[model samples]
Target: MEKTYLRAVEVDQWQTRQDITVTIPDSFDREVMASLPSLPDEPEKAVEWSGMLEMIGNASGVLWQKDAEVESLKTQIEIQKKAMLDECQGLQAELKEARDETHRANAAAALATNRAIKAEAWLQQVKEALASGFAPHLGRAPVERPSVLLAR
Candidate 1:
């Protein structure tokens, strides 16, 4: 059994250096060693052909999956953001509607109070006219204010 030293050859205009150390296992001649390309200073560059190809393929697949997952997460985040924005707008609209309803209710209450005051003033005037007919001296002077009834 003869020791077969592994070697590497730099190909013309290629980034990858070819493994030129594929020994004819049965050949034990020293002249065969001379024909092989020179080995590099770094021994890690030499690898079993099948294993290195598998590693490269697996790495590419993982990178592709990572990119796809990132895109999916980004889309989900955008959808969630849009939903939150829509909810905010809906809440704002509801708040505005509530404010408008409160304003209308306040205006209606003020109008009702004004009408009540006018009605009370008219009723007092009519009462005074009726009393003047019975006493004959009720309407001879300045009329008493309706606000005096509220004070009593």
Candidate 2:
């Protein structure tokens, strides 16, 4: 059995690309390589394994807090979206109601105009009958004839 140590180096400035060469204890490297998994990209797998351990140990709480915040924001956005949709529906209903009222008012006005036309026709018929001294047979007396003969 052998012991292996992990090391990481920091850079002072950003670089376009960076490569690291790791130096391992001679006996530790030989032992670790012998027990390695049979993966095609063993180097990348080794790096991922090291990262997983570090994340579990140090960054779990930070990741959990960020996830919770994101969920809270999503819930608030959904609530706001629903509120906006409800308001739009209410406005649409009000507009439809107003249109219905306008249609009813227009129909009433048309009916009133038709009634006025019929009343005017009746008045003209009555004027002609009075001028000609015509009386109905329904027990109604004749209307007074115009007084052109009164001067005689």
Q: Which candidate number has the best TM-score?
A: 1
The residue ranges of model 1 lying beyond 4 angstroms of the native Cα positions read 1-46, 134-152
The worst-scoring run of ten residues by lDDT in candidate 2 lies at 1-10
Per-prediction TM-score to the true structure, in the order listed: 0.56, 0.43
Model 2, runs deviating above 4 Å: 1-62, 131-152
Q: Which ten residues in a row have the lowest lDDT in candidate 1?
A: 143-152
Residue 63 CA error for candidate 2 (Å)? 3.8
lDDT string, candidate 1, 20-105, tens digits:
54433334344454565657786566445444444655675576567668979999999999999999999999999999999999
RMSD of 2: 14.5
Instruction: Supply candidate 1's per-residue lDDT for 142.
Output: 50
